[model samples]
Structures are given as structure tokens and as C-alpha cells.
Target: MPGVKATALSAAILVSAARAEPLKVGGIDLDTPPSHCAPLRDAEVPKAATLGFVSGAMTASAVYWIHREQRRRRQPGKATHPREWAIWTRLDRKKKGYVTRKDLKSLCYRFESDEHAEHLAKQLDPWGMDHINFSSFINNFKVVQMMRQAGRLKLWHRCCGLGVAGNVAGHMAQAGEAGQESHSATKPAAIFSYYMPPHPYQVSDQQADKKRLQEFPVTYAVIDYPKLPGACKVQVEPELGLLVDIVYTKDRKRVDHLVPRRVAAFNDCSIRSLEGAEKLSMKKNWGFGSKGISLRSFPVDGFGPGTFVDFLALVSYMKRDGEVFQYSVKAPVRNYLLFHEPLLEWIVEQINGQKDTDKWEEIFPQLAASDFPTSSWIALGAGEYTDYGATHFLQPLDEVVVVVYDERVMPDGPGMAQVLEMFEDTPAPAGSVMLHQTFV
Candidate 1:
């Protein structure tokens, strides 16, 4: 009470009074009407009277109480409507927090509710606004039937690259040399694992004589070059990631069908110099944002032959010391040995039976533990790295960029020539999934 202001005390009293069944104002009961001796019984001093008649204390108290009530109503948890929260979480992944007309349009398409997209947009952007602050939008509107199911949706990562391209043999050799094992039996492999950030067992202050486990060095969209044991060298593997719908059989409970929903730019970012590591995923999983994927994605239906993704190519760039250089081969998706249905088939097989090797492990047992996740991050391998990107390792302050876009949508021109022309442009073109990760 020593430092408490009179107005603050008055507001606190008013809020306390609000909780009771019969409200009392300044010790005057409202439920029993007014007593003859009540201070405000016959007069409208606080409500209708001007400054001349009302005491300064009373006026200030009224103003403070109203302000406090409005503030309380606007608090985040209570204020954010359920439907708005649903739309926010859905958009949070795709839009990365900001919502615009274009974003809403895409969301509508994803949810198959385009008819209500404009209406919802109007609610968030009444005056035809541009980007709606995610918080403001969620606090204002409620959407029906748009709630995604509640569950701890595990994010599964599927790394691809058996023998497609990008110097598969060369990588295998490097892996074998690091692990001191023969490379002859090495085959294409995939890992079905989710990222786990640093746990109590993973981190410690006292440096051990052996090797220290690397932790996830970042939290947001940016990737960090983690300091690891055994002369570590980190590199970015530019790959295309897919979000799929899994179909499971009742009796088997295994993933029977894989339907790719969306495709986006992904950096299957990894560690290159691991000494005698048993599993490939050991070098892969460091923590949250250890890998980079674009929040924006293109539907997969139009991505097959003669489709959008068929004409699309994956490109990568690395920026160092104000200079940007091509980091990986701009390869077309169709060029990949296995793609579309075939790629899906290969992934399922790899999950079920691919044998483990020194360089990589099949992780079938791991998948089984997670109940064979239907949804996963399918990384379809990185393209050929540039001579410089291949040799040079990632360092702090370095920027890695990966983009996926359609060449068919480009201005009419020759086949591969148009793609080359498109890649030569300084910045990534529109309608492209450009994932940017700043290492540090």
C-alpha cells in the first residue's frame, strides 16, 4: 500500500466487487437498490455529471476500471477465439506467422474451402488490407470446421539418395573412409527419424575426454554450424522435401499407400566429418531448425510429368563475404531415377527392408517404434554440389539458399536453355519455394 496509487487501488476494488453476486460500489449495495443515505443514491454524479460536480477521485476511478476491464478482455489466451487459433496454427506453418490475401487463398485451396477464403480475409482485412498480423487476425475471427485434429504430430524425416546422382559413390567413399570400413557394400539408404533438441543427457558443462555430443544450435528458421566432436565439417545438402498423406491397412497397420501432398525446398543439411558414427542420423539430428525447409509449398498434383514440378528444377546458392555462388546442380525433378509413384514405392521398401551399412542405416526398427508414421519429410537427395561447395565446409555467417520452381511457367523458350537462363537470374524467381538458412 505504500507505493500504490489511489486510482490503482480503486480499480482493484472494482474488479473484486465484479466477482460477487450482489455488487457493491464504495460500500453502497446495488442488489438492494439504493439506501437514502447512499453517497450516489439519487444523483448521477459519476455517470452523467461533468467535471464540475464529480470528484476527481471518482472520475479517475471510473476511467481506470473501464481501461482495466478492456485490457483484461484483450488478454491473449482468453481473447483468441478457438476458430481463429485454428486458422492461426494452420497458417503459422505455411505463412510463418504473417497472413496475406495470397496466403489466405493458398490456405483455402489446401483446406478445400476457397468459398470462405475471401469472407475470412474480409474479417481479418476489412479494408482490403495486405498482411494481417497473425495475432490480430486470430484474436478477431472464428472459423468453423477448420480445426485440425489434436495430437503430438511427429515430424518424420526421410533422406533419399541411394544411387541417383550427385556423386553417390564419392559420398559413400568419404563415409567409409571416415568410419574405417569398406565401401563396396554401400547402397542407397534412408533414415526414418525425427529431430530431438538437446536433452538432459545430451548436454553438459564439464568437457569429457572422449567426444562431446553436438546440440541443436538454433531455434528459429536459421541454421547454425554446430561445433561437434571429431574434427567436424558441416555442409548443406540441397534437396526437395515432400509432405505426404499415408494410407494404412487395418490388419497390417503398416503404411500401405503414400500420397505426396506438397513439395518445397529443403536443405538436408548435414555433418560431413563424423568418425566411426554408427547411424547416419546421428550426424543429422542436432536440434530444432538444424534442417531447413520452406514454409511455402506447391501442391504435388501438378508436379508430375507435364505437370508443374516436372518443369521445375532445384537450385542452390551459397553467399560468403558478399559474394553469392551457385552451390549445387540445377537438376530437374524428372531426371531423378525414382520419382512420383516409383519414388514413393522405393521409400516404403527402404523403410521396411533396406539393410543397414557403415555409411547409413535403414532405421526400420525406429520407424516401427513410431508406429510407421504416415506423414513425413521426404528429402529426395541433394543435387551435385559445385566444386567449391563440395570442397568447402559451412562456417558461421555463411548463407545457404535452396529453391524449387517451375520452368514451364517461364516465358516461352528452348527446353533446358530456359532453365539455365532462369537460374542465371540474381534472385530466385516468383512461384518458387526458396528456403534461406543463415549459418551461425
Candidate 2:
């Protein structure tokens, strides 16, 4: 068997190949690529509902009859959708298209109601045709996963990637996974935490006793100084954020699928010390911008392939006393503590089985009640801290900057070998996704 590094390369190539063309699995050949064409004109579709109803019924009848006649005229086996256009081209006897909304519901691996199916059909049929155009459809839908409603980031259960908190102990434990061997006795792991925004009112017994939890106020972004509570020490945890799509059974009691779609630079910032802290979340949330994430993101197309994310690197800096200090070691996302498909499966298992303890909070009940959250944003984990970052805490008038950039896009020359090489004297470069925040 190939070593982990070789296996990773093989997996990446497989993922890239799957993305490049129609996929066939389990001995089933898929549909041929669709022809390129502009969306159908508005004039081709009836405007009024009455006209549409009548036309739709007539069109259905005509299509059904024509399809039946065609099937009768063709040879027995040839009546099926052409082998080249196999799965993508499931010629519906009634719908008059290769694929329909019902087919999409099954193929996409998510179950939906009638209304949801119609909504998907409307989005896919840009020209008002009920059928989807496979090529254009793949270009738009396959790359990104969106939530039905913009879910409150507060609703999200913020999970912290741990096992990187200290220098010698944490580093030694996780080093082999970072090096070529990729196997380890002490596996790096993640812990669950949650944020509670400051609110004036007290939690009443009526609210706490209810089956559904009350919604908390959400602060998704901040550009200025954040209000630090009391005199607690605070530090930023620079990491990458992964947005995942989760599907659940109709009963909403259990999760069926969990897939990552987009990756963005993230700051899993936290307080240095908290009194009687049971879970890490107590250190995580304080107020608006308590956590930081870049406004920009890239899709994880075949995540292992690195086609979309490998070029990126994470670096953070602190501006204090009129001078800038590198606050965290520059690390690539691929060098993260845990990643790829094994990590993905591990996370799903963690959510389902993790129990409430003196040091960790239970996640299974929260997830089940939230219907497995159609979406989740997860921080990959933090990297090695700089000397200054390890010693100093946030003080008033200090500035913190975190950036994620495509190192592959770094310009050539003696001064520009890497992003850090260009960071000595100048401000952050143009293409990097940067977040600059000040302490108040």
C-alpha cells in the first residue's frame, strides 16, 4: 500500500478527475455533457398563470405522447436515455426532459418537500423551462452550498481545533502528522464550545425549560475596536474556517451527510483566562467581532486536490508601539492538525457522540434540536504562536491583523520569495484577505 503522502496525491488526482467531467460510479455511466446555449427567452414562456396552466397541461400531454411514440419507434434497448448522457439524461416520459426536479432530489442526496423541489426547479431553470441544463447547472450549483436562510452565526456551535495550545508538548504530539509520516500515537483532536452574547435580561425558568432554545443576538463582523469585558486577557487564534453542508433525516433526529464546501481564513480568538471555565466556549465569545473570519472565501472543489485551497497560507501580525510583530508562525492550511476525509468523518462522529463533561459541552442534543443545522462554519485549528504572541495579551490601542493569501501568487524576486519575505516593511499585499482590528 502507498504511504499517506502518496495516498494523498492519488486521492487529489481522483477528486480532480471527478470534478472535470460527468462521473460514473458502481458500473453506471452518466449522462454526456450538455450543449451550451443562452437561457430561453421570456417570450417563449406564458406570462399569466391561467395561460401557463393551460399551456403546461397541453405541453405535458404533447410531450408524453411524443415520447411514447418515439419509444415505440426505437429498438427495445435504444429507447433509454443515450449511454453518453446516462444519469444526467434520464428522459422522463412525462416531463419531456432528461432530468426533472424529482430526479434532482435523489441525485443531490438531500430529501425535500414539494415546495422545496419546485424552488430548486425554478433556480435551475433560468429560462423558465422546468428541466435543468447539466453543464450550466454544474457550474453554478456544484461548487457552492448555500443555506435556505442566512443562519445566525450565533446558532452555530463553534468548535475549536485543539492540541496546539502549548509549544513543546503539543508540538511533539502533533509533529509526525505534520511531517511526511502522517501517522501518530497521540492524534490531534477538536473540542466543542459555544458563544453567549452579553444580554441585559436574565434567563427565566420559562425560557430555559422549553424544548426549543431561545435565539441569541448575532454579531458576524466587526471593523473597529471591540468592547473587552472586565480586565480579562484576550488573544487571537488564527486558523482557517470551513463551511459545511449537513443533511438530516426527515424526522430531524439524526444527520445523514456532512460535507465541506468553502474555506475562509478565520480567527478563533479567545480569552486567555476565565474563572471556573467548564468548556472552551467560555473563553471564545464576548461581543461583536469576538471571532474573526475573512469576508472572502474559496470553494473546496475536491478538497484534497488542493486545486482551490492549497496555494493559501495563514499569517497574523500585531501592531504595537509603532512597530509590527509577526504574531503567529506562517503555516499552510494543508499543514493543519487534522484534515481531508478522515477528519470529516471524525467530526460527524464527534458531534453525534460527544457528551457534556466538566471540560466539554454536549453537542448531540443541540444538533438534533437544530435539525442538524443545514450549515456550519468550523475553525480548522491554530498554528504555532510567536514569542510576542505567547507573552503578550491584548492591550488598549493595540492593532491585530490576520491574513490568508495565495502564496502561489506571490511575485518573483530576491525580496519576494514568500509572503513573509515581503511583510518586513510594507503593509499587507493587494490579493490577501486581511482583517485588521484594534483593542479598545
Tens digits of per-residue lDDT for model 1 on 246-343?
A: 56667654557667778888887777767766666666666544677665678867435565667767777777776777777667766665566666
List pairs with backbone clashes in candidate 1. Answer: 162-188
Residue 171 in candidate 1, Cα distance off native in Å:
6.0
Report, for every candidate in turn, its global Cα lDDT versus the true structure: 0.57, 0.53
Residue-level lDDT tens digits of model 2 in 236-256: 677777777776667766666
lDDT of the structure predicted as candidate 1: 0.57
Which residue window of length 10 is worst by lDDT in model 2? Answer: 159-168
RMSDs, each prediction? Answer: 14.8, 27.9
Poorly placed runs, candidate 2 (over 4 Å): 1-185, 195-231, 411-431
lDDT of 2 at 134: 44
